[model samples]
Target: MADDRFSMGLFDARIKDQRHQVFKVLGMYFVLMTVAIWGLLSLFWGSTYQLESYFPSVKVYVYDFDSVATPNAVLGPAVVRYLQSTLSSPVHLGIIVRDPAGKTFDDVASEIVGEKAWGAVVINANATSNFEAAMAGTGGLLDGQWAPKGAISLVVAGARWYQVVLEYLLPYLGMYVETPVLEASHQASASFLSTATPATLGELTSAQQAALGTPFAYQEVDLRPILPGQWAGAAPLEAGLIYYIIFAFHIALFFFFSRLPLQGMTKKHGIKIRWIHVCLLRIVPVLFAYFILSLAYTLINKAFLLPTDGNGYASFGPQAGFMVLWMLDWIALASLGLAMEAMLTLLTLKFFPLFLITWILSNITSSFFPATLAPKIFRYGYMMPFWHCTTATKHIMWGTRNRLGLNFGVLLGWCGVSLVTICLFELMWRRIEERKERQESAKDVEGQGAHK
Candidate 1:
């Protein structure tokens, strides 16, 4: 009895052996987790590191409608020449010189609204004519109003990408587009004033003289303006994405624990259930859970009074828009939750947190930044669920391009992939468990025979 007690004591050889085994296990865990964390950080941080290098990928059309025959196509041609020169500069863009032959300003605006181009600098058809007339003191000018601003239309769809537009595109336009155009107008006006007869000089009114000072101002037409109230919509696109995955993961965890009692009843209380029924039991409840969770999630946006009327983009009324948003949230939740559920079977609880970090990082990195401004690798974000969901959310909230069909299709495709993988993984895990149980029972039988 003394020897047996000694074997179980703190100094026992068995205890010493187990300590080495524990250390070895911890060492391996630490090394692998460190590698995983570093790898994930690299992926997350790499996306935006050289974003400025890819600035030229953002296409901005420069349509020179004013370059046609007029007394002097000075302002329009000067603006286009200055903008084209910037293509070779350090901070350049995809400044495509669009043929303004048959394309009207409306056509250019449509291209922007349809997302064919990030933005446009339309030297309006009347740009030179209007400015020349204003300079000649013969054009229509309202009281204290500037006409050159209306001469050039700078078309941008803010809802296309609020952050990208605000941060990069708008500033780029201000620098490369607005600045050059203003300079050209001022120079043109100065040259005209230098050669003007006393009659032309005296004809200039105070408002017209002010307009001549800045002869070519751009009228910034944001087809889909991101209103102040709509700033709350960023939640779903940015930080809220992490919360979405966390919520889905918790739902998976809750149901996993909930199923344990049923599993115990089958094992300990001699209760029986088919494996297919078990799979259904796990999947169906989570789907319903996402449905409820998504509605509650959407209601938070609604409660905060985020616009649901598509901000003048879509035809959906307030109530219909709310329902659309709810449905979008439901599908987005299902896409995120189902994928987590599928991965949980293969990764299990021990290793799932690593996968969780990878999932969140991958989705967040791809969705948060515009792919055109990032490396080509991030263009894969176009297919990611978070990207599509973010795009659809913008469409629903701020009225960006209405690609609802494609967004929904991609999200549902992710759901389909998750569903198939869940079934396969569930079946695989079940087979593994059954095989372990069979091996355990065989060992027991062999031990009993040896005892006899």
Candidate 2:
């Protein structure tokens, strides 16, 4: 007979049994993956759910320097009243009315630069007096005529949280505060103009007449601007973070594969290698590999012309910034990769994808959205690697805040924890493998005895 085992009929009983076993395994895997995917989806979606409800956490200071205006000026008080009324609404920001006493515009600007506040609204000093003087044509001339842009200033640090400032905070301020204040100021100016004498009106130049019609104009000042073409440099802090994690995982994987030949030499060729040496081999090479990979990664960014020098946006000089960024990438890779290496030893290739999904989702959620705009539970993001990395990267690229010490400390802490876990897990994995080999040896001895 031909090889019946290898050439079974379509309806053979053996074929039916094998097909059934394959289907059962596939069904189990499908169900497990479905549940795992649902859980990960919930985690990512929950981070951004009802995000607007947490808007109050993003604080903005509104200081009315024009509060003690001349008796006739209603612009400053009217704007303050309108902004205060918004505090009662369900969807309102943390609009704090700061005491202007002992505080100047420079002070408020400094506070924003220091990351003390997200943004600020300042009604300039002598705002009402200046408007009154301009309307009466009595103020000192500029460029041979008196003309002011506005009495109010909207100060922001756009590079702090670029998307949030542009999308939520700026729009909210425009809708609730700026629009009504401008309308009320225009109405008040028109009323004042309607009652003015011709002599007073004629004394006003064309510019002064126009200024009287809109006496409450406002100027927007972004302290730390995220200028055009700078988003390339910011990539590592955003979606590039996810890519970095993936690269780190692959680096661990590449090393894992590279070890197979050494294992083959030890097992098939009887080459002696100590277990402790093997463990060290796994970790020490990873550090060197990350150092080189990080240098390449930083160089790629530089090749793309991502600004590294102190271009008024960053404080570090050209070569110094590049060195700092390379060091950061090296630590980040080690922190992220070492943990995956530890987990891989325990979970093995079969189940590692489940852990990988959770790791990516958790880090991305924390880094992509500002904790201030998310639920209180997300405050833990402060401890996550991605959040610190993003914060530090922004500071390096855009000079947002100087927290390098804290950032480096946290990243190094992660590396230490991962290093410990890797060693312990590697030892455990070797113990399990040795136990399996001993069991197989015992079985072989019994079979040989039975054969005799």
Candidate 3:
């Protein structure tokens, strides 16, 4: 029987062949992982100083007509202050009024927008009270959202920081709109809308309490103790989805290329590992291995030279589980990669095709840089697994626990599909193996007959 003890012993012994290659593979893997981890650590380590260098510094030039020069001075500072109040102040960005060669506001916008400028805000004459009106009213003239009654050009860069400025732009355009995240919750306006509104100063007062209904509402989106930390502070659901896809591919590649070639970890004497069994076997091994990797990653990120702050105990188990579940997807990738390797192994190809595919996809996916930063056309491409894993790892390190559940779900899907694929491949191989055995036996019988 295939289950005979002596046969099993020989089968087990076959694994030793793989042992010869382990140290070499491990050395290569260690070098690569170490370089990557160190480079990442260096960036975050330097972020403290690098963050200060910019200090909200994006020099946005605002060229306006002389008529609005007085309003510009007042409006500029007010815009800067509003920005300061709303944003997390990592950058020092503001509008600077300059009339180079006495060019008109339109002239400046035309020149700058074409030269790859970030954004532009042109204030109309008598637009000073617009900010004041906005602080007091909802929106209409200088006191409303969009165009600010007389604003000329307020085009967004349509790139990385669009969301950051989309809602806030109206507040600065004519100082008329107030779109605060917390305006709906807790309902605390600046506690005072306009400190300089004529109506408030000239008419409304505490002494005339009966006439005044209530002051304007002010609110700010303050997520203090930002739960997931800086690395995982983004929209969790979307981010988690992305990371799940990326890591699925990475682990799958590692499994197919690295783990399988190690020999005994994969090969099993004459047993035809159907695609299903192949997939199942891989899933079991990798789930154990990968989760451990996740744990190792977490420990290093937390307790090492540079620790990523997060809820360690709560985070470690869930993130590791999520990371392991990704093997389903890894199985799919591993299937494709292994197929290529299998072809090379049998046919002696000059190079492994899967490596190129993995490398290319890895570059585009699981990148540390944001996919949204990619050109609008390419943004969706980044949603694939390669990018997702990078983001997911960051999420895990940042203690974003809720997303761990979501990642686990997505990864499970990949595992199921991969298991099916492996079973199919194994069945095909079994037939081939059986046929070869028959051919060899027939040749042996023919040789006996010739001797007779």
> How many residue pairs clash (N, CA or C atoms closer than 3 angstroms) in each of the candidate models, in the order given?
0, 0, 35
Which of 1 and 2 is the better model by TM-score? 1
Task: Give lDDT for model 1.
Answer: 0.83
lDDT of 3 by residue, 239-353 (tens): 4333433454455556666655444533456444445655455557655655554454344333432223333423346445444434423432443333333433332333343
TM-score of each: 0.92, 0.91, 0.37
Model 2 residue 173 CA deviation in Å: 1.1
Q: lDDT scores for all predictions?
A: 0.83, 0.80, 0.41
At residue 170, give the lDDT of candidate 3: 28
Which is better, 2 or 3, measured by lDDT? 2
TM-score of 2: 0.91
Q: Which residue ranges in model 3 land beyond 4 Å of their true spot?
A: 1-281, 304-353, 356-360, 363-383, 391-407, 447-452
**Steric clash pairs (candidate 1):** none
lDDT of 2 by residue, 302-406 (tens): 887776653565667878988888898889888888889888888888777777787888888888788887777778888888988888777777777778899
Window of ten residues with lowest summed lDDT in model 2? 140-149
